[model samples]
Target chain A: MRSHRFYTPWLLMLPALVWLALFSVWPAINTITLSFTNVHQLTGGHYIGFKNYWLLWHDPHIRDAVLNTIVFMVICVPLLTFLPLLLALLVQRNIRGIAFFRTAFYFPVIASAVTVALIWKWMLDDRGLFNNLLQTMGFVHKTVPFLTDRWLLLLSAIALTVWKGLGYYMLLYMSALGSVRRDLHEAAAVDGAGTVRRFWSITVPGVRGTMILISVLIAVNAMRVFSELYILGGATGGVGGQDVSIVMLVQQAASGSDGRLGYASAISVFLFFLTAIPLLFLTRLNKNNQEES
Target chain B: MTATTAEDSREGRKRRVRGTGAVRHPDRKGRSPIFDAPTPHGLFFRYLALIIVLLISIGPMLWELSTSLKSKAEDVYTQNIQLLPHHPTLGNYGEVQNTIPVWHFALNSLTVAVINVTGNVIGATLAGYVLARLKFKGRKLLLGVFVATLILPAEVTIISKFQMITSMGLGNSILGVCLPDMIAMTNVLLMRNAFMALPREVEEAAIIDGANVLQRMRYVGLPSVKGVLSVISIFAFIGAWDDFLWPLLVLQSPDKLTLTVGLSYLNGQWSHDPRTIAAGTMMALLPILALFLILQRYFFRGVAQGAIKG
Candidate 1:
């Protein structure tokens, strides 16, 4: 009976464990091993110790991708992280028709990234609605190249990301804001605290943990942003592949005409660390913040 | 001095009323204010902010809808931006159908998404039940392993997964596309959280009634977590439906393509025609949007639950 009891749980877990091992764990281990080799998709290659890493270190295109990704992350993190807080605050009211506003804000998050990117691409095209509006409003005489120009391409991608992601992050904050005791704000208000003062002192501190979570989520997403760039940048990354992200670089290296699987694995490994390190740092920072508070 | 004392007492009464959570009379109107209730000026600004946000959020999608409906002769290029089409027609949708095998892709997507949702809900629920209700050694470690995979991005493992699927002869098949994603860690965790939240005595009663583990799971465990199951189903469906990269990587044939990958291909093929692309995009978006509209409350609740527990 004891033995049966002991084994039953494992029996229940068997299918999931098998699935995880075959897919996640094995692939993770293979990814690490493949990163050390010079394997191509068609031709099997021998173990090349750190050669891919060395090439990655010296590769200009990889450098450009890394720089662009960082720039994109830097621009997006603050905008997405803080802007949603304001949105959440605005929508977190009990006023009439607030549900409509909340639903409207959350609308973009339901669409696929491909759909979102396609819509934005049409809007930002030289002859698209945005440029037409600009020209109509006399903002610019000539059509602006939103996706063709180098920096503007990056900016356009960032805008699409922020636009799509805003509602998701806002929803997170809204949930967090919901939990914050109403009386705390009321008490603070009665103590002669102004709107900004109460927001900083009470609301900010109240949702600090969620703020950390949102930032980490945004950071991870910012690093993994590929479909937007892929669709918007015409698959090769717009204008000299200047707007290519790290994941995009990995995809290009792995599946591009060259099909450098080993090199792509190395870039994937690089991306893994790049993502993991900041996540670790953020969690630790959050821990410290908690302790301090 | 009398007037000042009367005002102080009135303020105290207002605070007490708010503290007690009493509903004010309708005639009181805006006499007493809570922290969230903005003043008239603040209300003006709040509506202003909300309108701007609503526009920014849904404006592009509405624009896509408008563009999709516009007649080909309208010339979106040189024409001033029109919120509504001058001569609205479903002509672009027809063009999309003639241009690409859209229904074929939609059916493929539906197949993959349904299989994924069903597989995930069942698999995750059983695993979550075991983890939540059954006491076993190393269960904590097992749960830890499942949770750890959440952080490992799909990019890290795509190469090997692709290799494995191809070697297994599952490539270009819908099952191949759904295989890797059959058991999502998020769904498992969500289920675990859901099962954990249920009352323990209910399961104990089932066990005491001579019901077996499977019986208890079927009768007691599954019914209680229907909300979580629905959430899991919705998420799994959405994830599978919107999936581009894995489908893009796995399925190469046009006939086997999911809607997202097919639409992406269509976007490239029809780059010169914005209306056709918009129509295709809109078509791809409509089903998910309808699902979302019907299940908006559940969707928002699931997101909130994920944010909190996850």
Candidate 2:
């Protein structure tokens, strides 16, 4: 190996190291420290030792957020995990003008989360296209309050998340599918296997590891739902103000001039642990996978 | 010839198989044989599924575009839904600006994206080169610092970041909004991977020629990593442009707000007129969409490489 002066590598890495210290490492430590205090947006405070966590434990908003997060995860993990694999399979084959189809599907993924949510919000407005179409078709005379209801608002956000997520995860699966045996389905077909049958026995097992990784990704992403719900359910979580997520709770606690920075830090610590469960599970699964392999 | 269509009609399919549904593979004619030549029914269902997914993915954005173009004469909301506008005009786009400084906010967003793109490209390139190519002590430990942060989702650290920005007197500033993400660890690691893939023979050859680290990197490493550099820059620009939560927390002044923050403000403050909101959304969307369209080859390639390596 070619030797370098002791300061050379350090010189090259200085900028990134400064950024890591200032942004990632320091903030991680400060978040835990600040959670023990009662800091606001404008004021610093002495440590009260878990009082903020105590309040968070009893907060009704936290309960609503927890319930909403669970709902978001339960629906999203299964749906996002399976649908994108089919989408990848659809676009993976070489056919006429396949490149155009592949890029076009990823448009929603490229668009900002705010823009798509706004587009969806406009479409689902009381007199918007969907409601208007329903009324015109004599399906319903009155408008549906999709954005105003608690459960519907949450569901609408989940739908938007899945819609935008399809192309992103499709890309991931597309890459993973590159390694799969191309002719296995044909062999399985001679055993009288149907399309779904081939998918379960062949494709699913082939990319079982990717599926597990994607499920963990979906779970973690679902827990961090913000822009979709924030836009669809209004700033205060629609009418009932209860269709909120954990990240939404973080934003609410630490936003505006009267923001509770300490309380928000506590909630953030909670959100961190919430996301870590899946990540830890993934690590454990990976270890098991390694042992088997 | 547009990139949107499933198949352009001008490229004639000479096979002329009627109703059997096997459209001749126009491009990739040679490799097509090695790939599965789908039967007529299979081709039909595949294209059908492709069309359906295409609709579900982009149909709303199209509807939003159509809604944004309708003139004042047309009733936006009616019992009989009319997708085709009676009269189309660009007035709603102007209305979005008059109500809020839409272009000004877009300019601010561009500034942030430009700064971030520049920062990530230059900074990550240096850090990645040293980490991957240079021999140094504690290099693995330095890399571990970068990898560990990937586990901490950016959002969880927002509270502390907000605190630090305020403490640094960067609150309500664009610099504050752009700082934390300027050298994202993901991009750095990606660049490191790219540099690592460079052939060791060239580096050895460069050393034999008495080329220092800078010259060796510039000649050997830089040229190969250019593709990945461009890919990460595109991602950086898009991330900075589309970002919401961080900008929302750090920026408070109406004038300094990015497009995302401004668009949301427009939603709440000018809660009337769906047309104007749609117009605002389009303005934030179109620039990045155009960039992605032009460079989608690189985008797909980058993501595929990223997925494989990751």
Candidate 3:
């Protein structure tokens, strides 16, 4: 029986539905349509029949963006996936002052990307702390070009991203670790299995699903990275301006009065496919898990 | 073994709680003990590892705070890196204010964050309650719309959201920055999951008593979802307060910049001063960091209740 009046549910859902329809659903479809046109910030044109895609196909910056993204994903996915799990394992047990450790570890995750990246940028500057230390130790006679050089800058941002992400993924793994049955651990220990042995055999399998889910999250985030690269490499994306991510390129295209809205929309559509495929597959797996259960 | 005894006590407590309607108080079961087998041999190593990670995590923030405090008298770029400020002063913080309208930018950030938190609390709660409890046509489809949003990354939708907001002439305004994120889909789905986990029998009893939907929701629904509410509010605050890219995109007028955007502008455009920049970073960071420290237990408590199971 309907306990509420007919309009009640619709009344409740109005704000959320409005937001979704206006911002999310409309933008998603409109992005595709806008990609085909020759729309700029101040002027517009009719369908250009893949002209923007043609430009994207040849853009040198686009080439750098893709290459940088691949390098970022290759290194970050494995490091972020496993390191956080280990951090989670380290802080898993209820011990004296564990809460303090947990809170401290989570500080980077809570701090803004701009703030953390800026902190790193300061340290990485020529006269900054690391360079001064290196010079004092006689390891380098001169300062390191951490921020200006393209490769060093990229590596620095990657390190910053990995460092910032550890606590977040650790939290996710912590929750998953809570559900791993303790009896199994005790059983394994009694059977002469060591801590590492138990962790590999029991702990890994128990949180295996979570590990997969986190890797997907890491992969998608790696693909869409913007703020770290933006802050560390300045707005122009480091020395030769080739350290930019795809999102940075979209931001560049969509800004300014002469902004190429159509080109940016095309890039957005391309990015949606790159990042969304894994998540959609994960959703499918989630559905199947629910069904079988 | 001590591990077996601890497990037995935990098991016995669960059975007793189960007899009493299985109403698990969130505070009690939050500390799960998979690694609680305190082998005296492992304690030293565990503490050692914990301290090592703690230093790595918190050391940068501390260094930043110290840098912000140091006076110009001390050589800050020393090889040994003096962490303690000699003549520690709030002078650099005042300098950050002088450099850019940092306080005004912080106020702008506060406005955006407050709007977002208020919006999510009301909008996501109502929508989440209806989808979870009320029997309505198209409920599944409505939930699907929120779920569908998950597949598309927020960056993908940025150009269109920007187009819509600027077309509405809300560009260069904080409201425009707040509009797109106010009722985040994840928060809505989180709330729905929270409400669904509430036992329905009590709500049914309210229904039997001729309580209307809003009445039942106000009396029964709101109380049970406090954990989820707190979690979402904390996150919404952090998301808006610390956000950089969106505000940077929307606000062009220098006077209207948020803290993160403003600090970045200071970094990129200003005649550079490390002390002043460090001070700006700390001002934007410490308040939110303090807030997180206070409310974090609630966050873990909420997660442990299977709120993320959805």
Candidate 4:
């Protein structure tokens, strides 16, 4: 009976464990191993020690991609982190029709990134709605090349990302904000504090955990951003390939006609660390905060 | 003299109270303070802020809708920016169908999404039940493994996953697309949390009634976590449906392509025609939007709980 009891739990766990091993764990191990070889799609590769790493160190596009991804993350982190909080605050009131506003903000969260990207592409097109509005309003005499220009292309992609992400993060913040005690705000009011003071003193500190979580979430998301850039910039990244994220670089390298699988795997490994390090740092910080509290 | 002084004080107090009442109830309307009552200036600014935020959130999609409805006869390229279609037409939607196999791609997407949802719900439920209810050694370690997987980005493992799928001869098929995503660690964790929160007595009662492990799972465990199951299913459906990169990488045949990938191909094929792309995008959005609208309350609750717990 003891043996049967012990075995039943393992049996229940078997299917999930098998799935994860086959897909996640085994693939992760393979990725690390593949990073050392000069594998191509047609011809199998031999072990080439650190050659891909060496190439990665010297590659200018890799450098550009790393920089662009950092820039994207830096720009998006603040937008996603705070804008959603503000949106949540705005809708957190007991005002009439607040549900409508909340739902409107959350609409894009459920919408597919592909559909979102397509709509934004149309809007950002030279002859699209945005340029049309600008020209009609005498903002610019000539049509602006939003997607064709490198900086503007990056900006457009960032805008689309922030737009799509606002609802998701807003929902997160809203949930966090809901848990905040009403008496804190009322107490602050009784103490003759102004709205801004109450917000800064109470609301901000109240949802600090969520804020940190949001920041880390946004940062991780920024690092892994692919579909937006891919959809806007095409497979080669944007314009002169100036808009390539690190992940985009990996995709281009691995799937390109030359089939630099080893090089791609090296990039993937680099990406893994790049993403993992900050996450580890943040989680440690979260753990410390929890312990202190 | 003391009585006169007391009368004077009472009169002053009455005047003060009446004055305060006049100020508080300036509109002479008894509106419930708890419900629909805010100062006019405050309400103005609040509504203004809300409208602006609402416009910013949904404006682009609404613009897409407008563009999709715009007749081909109207020149969208010119300086004239119309918020509403001058001559609205359903022809663009129909044109999308004629241009590409939109329905076919959608069917592919639905198939992949449904299968993925099924896999995730079944797998996560079983695992979650074990982790939650069953006292097993190494449960903590297993949970840590799951959480670790959650933190790892899909990009890190895509290449190896692709290679593995190809080796198994699952390439260019929906199964290939669904295989890697069958067991989402996050969903399992969510389910585990949900199952753990259920009363212990329910499962104990089932066991006392001579129900075995699987029987307890089917009879007691499954029904209890139906809410979380729905949540997992919804998220799984959305994840598989919106997934672009995996489908793009795995599926080679045009016919095998999911809707998102097919839309990208459509974009490349009809690069200049915004109307067709807009129509297709809108068509793609409708089902998700409808699902969202219908299940929004549950979605909000699930998302909030998931975010907090995970």
Candidate 5:
């Protein structure tokens, strides 16, 4: 009877387990299998060995994607890590109209990625609002190329990405902050620590676990950026000039005008690893942080 | 215990400092410096930070509002873009609906969100209760598996999930949008945390009174975790409602498109005159804003309580 009871939890969890296996696990395996095959339209192509991987390595577009993705990830992860912690700190106090502030911060989160991209696209347009506003304010004499300019485009994307994402991470940090015992804060305060000192000594250490978690989450998300970049016409997997991100390159290889199955697979395979490395490091960091906390 | 006394004294001091209606409102002046005491520079810094955050965060939305009110002629050559409209008009909103079927897209989003929310609530609570209350084998393993899913980025599986849905004929339907998301892992973790935080004695008494697992769960566990369930459901609703990529890939027909996808189509066309697109986008976001307002009070309290409980 006791043994039978052991299976009850598994039985209860069966639906979710089944859903993940069928929808998530099987599809991943299939994607890997399909990555190696040639596209024959109907029957699909024969098993091509490392031909795809080889082609992916040599392709200039694929190479550009790899470089671009690295740059975006490197730049974004740190910004993503710090901004939310800062926002969480700023809003950690129980202020009036906190709900309004929260909703305001999270508004971008609720806004569709497409809407976000569109709004940014309009603002970034040469004759658009951003440049016009800046021009009027004497910030710039001419219309700044927010989208068309290669360097500026990446920054704008990062800005939008950070804006959309900051609130969710802030909320997570806020909740984690709430869990911290007040005694530590009291102790620090009594020791003549300033607000910043108290936060560093007591609050920061208290939410160390959450910080690591947020870091891992942000790193993984930053590495896998696609839709917003894609929508911004960064679809060409060339060395520069739109299609600038690595995910875009994988996408181009997957379903481009070229239709190179092997190349697409290789690019995806690289991306998988690129994303995985940071994620692995992140996990280790989180575990270490949790233990230390 | 010592903290409480310290907090009370601080509260008394805060009342003294404020001086207006001090006795009536025992303000946060007590306790620790973190919550109660205001530094001389704190309000200035707070407002400055708040203003900066609001600008960075709310700047784009304000830009959208400005563009939406701009005339097509003005939009093309408007040199000075004040956040306030020169001449605000509902013409864009009027034209947007006629140009594209906005209501159809909204309906699709609503249907998907509603179904997804219902599925999550049922599955999450039941599973959460069992994980939290029942002494079952492999519970820790199951929890580990659920937590592991959080690490598996949705982008990695998008291609595969699309293929699965298309093959299953669930593609292009509202079912496709909701089905995959219905078995959400984050909410399961949330619900489990909420359930676990409920005192053990209630369940022990239920068991002592000869109540079975199902009965006890129905009467005690469900009620206790309802707050968490609402929060998770709201989150799920928002996620499903605002989704873009999945709907873009699956829903091919213009009529079948969700609001976000439909707005994207509008955006590409009206790249010149984006006022209409902005109006449409704002319309799409209105329902969510309304929902948040209606449940504003509960959301913060419930989420904070649940997180602390975890």
Candidate 6:
């Protein structure tokens, strides 16, 4: 009777396990196999082995994409890491109206990113509110093209990324913050530690696990940035204004009327490797940390 | 008889310790003159910082609200600087409805989102329970795979997944969107965590009562994880509704589009029409806003608990 009971679970699980294998594993294998072929025009393909990858070295767009993605990550990751924790700390206080402010912060998390990029599209125009504010404040004599300027384009997108993303990260940190023992802080204060010192010594170490989690999340999300660039229309070589992110590069490659699936597949394969490296390290780190705890 | 003096001394020490800053932290600085009461400066500064964080976080959304009311020309010129519309009109909403079948897209979005939510709720709960309570083979490996998948960006599997959909003839259909999302990894992990926290004695009692696996789960486990299940429902809803990439890949037909993809079409047409675009954006936002407001109590609490458990 117990044996029969045990068998029922395996029977129930078969469908879900099959679904996972079909959607996730099989498709992943296909992506790997497809990357090895000269699948440029889609109809017929020869398995060209490493030829496609070798050719990638000559592709300037891929290089630019790699550079652009790195630049975006370098500029965005640290700020994204610390800013949310700071915001979470600020709001974790038992202050009046904190709940209202927290809700306000969460609005963008529920809003569509496509819509966010579009709304910002209008706001970042040459005569948009951003420039108008600067001009009104007498900060600049001429309107600054924050969106279109070659130098400022990535920065503009970074601002959007941080704005849209902070609340979600803040929530993650807030949860971690809530779990810290109150007595620990009291003990630190009694030991003559100041606010900043206690925060660095106590709060930072307490939230190290969350820091790792957010790092992995930010790194992965950085590599997959698309909707914002798509809304920007990618001509600017920045975000919506003029700069291009790597995801835009992939979208163009994949969906181009020219049907450069081989090229696109190659690009996707490269990204797969690029993303896999960080993921590998982070997962291992997570495992080791789990074991330690 | 000798115990009276010792008891009195202990009470005096307790009073002194309680009177210290350990019980209630006092701000070293004096209270605000404007408020005319002694509120800690630390608390005041924290509130101020949070307000700024809130503004930066939600400024664009509030901007969207005001921008939708302005005329197209005004958006081009003023952006979001103008607080109230100089001339507020419902013409944009009219344009959105007329230009595209907004209600149709909403219905499609709602259908897919609800179905996906139901599927996730059932699938994740079962899987979570099995992983948590059942001593089974391959459980640890499966859990590891799910965690790994959380870090595997969709772009990695996007093309192949698209191919799978096309091959299965699920492309351009709502089922395509719902099916892939139904078996989400994060929800599984969340459910596992929630199920792990369930008291062990309840299940043991059910076992002793000769309950079958299904009966035991229904009678003992499901009741305890109600909070986690609600969180899963909301997470599934938000993910399905706000999802653009997968829908864009699978559903090409404008008529069969979800709200996110449908809004993209309106946006493409009205790239210059601020009111039309904002109206469409607002329409996309309303259902989610409604869900959040209606479930605000459950939503935040679920978020608070879910983050810790997951």
**Each prediction's number of clashing residue pairs:** 0, 0, 0, 0, 9, 9
DockQ of 6: 0.47
Q: Judged by lDDT, which candidate is best?
A: 3
lDDT of 2: 0.87
DockQ of each: 0.61, 0.67, 0.65, 0.60, 0.48, 0.47
Tens-place lDDT digits, model 5, residues B48-160:
88988888887888778776777655644478455677678778888888889899888999998898888888777777777777776577877787777665566566666
Worst 10-residue stretch by lDDT in candidate 3 chain A?
A: A183-192
Model 2 lDDT per residue over A1-293, tens place: 55567898888888898999999999999999989999988876788997898899999999999999999999999999999999999999868989999998989988999999999998888888889888888898888888998888888999999999999888889978877765576457545576889888989999998999999989999988899998888778889999888998899999988799999999999999999999999999999989998
lDDT of 1 at A63: 82
Q: Model 2 segments beyond 4 Å from truth?
A: A190-192, B1-35, B307-310
lDDT of 3 by residue, B9-51 (tens): 6864665554453222223654323334365657988999998
CAPRI accuracy category, model 1: medium
lDDT score at residue B232, model 5, on the 0-100 scale: 83
What are the per-residue Cα lDDT tens digits for candidate 4 across B1-310?
9996697568546655645644344342333232223546778999999999889889988999998999999887776777899899998999888888889999999998899898898899989988988887898999888877877798899988877887789988988998889888777788888888879777777777788888888887787666667778888898888998888888878878889998888887754578888899988898988887788777666665552333
Ranking by lDDT: 3, 2, 1, 4, 6, 5
A77 in model 5: Cα distance from truth in Å? 2.7
Which of 2 and 4 is the better model by DockQ?
2
| TM-score for each of the candidates | 0.92, 0.93, 0.92, 0.91, 0.86, 0.88
Per-model lDDT: 0.83, 0.87, 0.87, 0.83, 0.71, 0.73
Single out the weakest 10-residue window by summed lDDT for candidate 5 chain A: A234-243
Scored against the true structure, residue A240 in model 4 reaches a CA lDDT of 91
- Compose the digit string of candidate 5's lDDT tens values, residues A101-218: 8778877776777778877877777788777778988998987877766667777777778878898788888888777777666666656677788877787788877776676667
Superposed model 5: Cα runs more than 4 Å off = A1-11, A39-43, A179-202, A234-241, A250-269, A286-293, B1-30, B33-35, B39-41, B72-76, B136-140, B307-310
Ranking by DockQ: 2, 3, 1, 4, 5, 6
Tens digits of per-residue lDDT, candidate 4, A27-131, equal 889999999999885577889999999999999888878887788888999989888998888887757888778888888888888899998999888888889
Query: Which candidate achieves the best DockQ against the true structure?
Result: 2
Q: What are the TM values for chain B, all candidates?
A: 0.86, 0.87, 0.87, 0.83, 0.82, 0.82
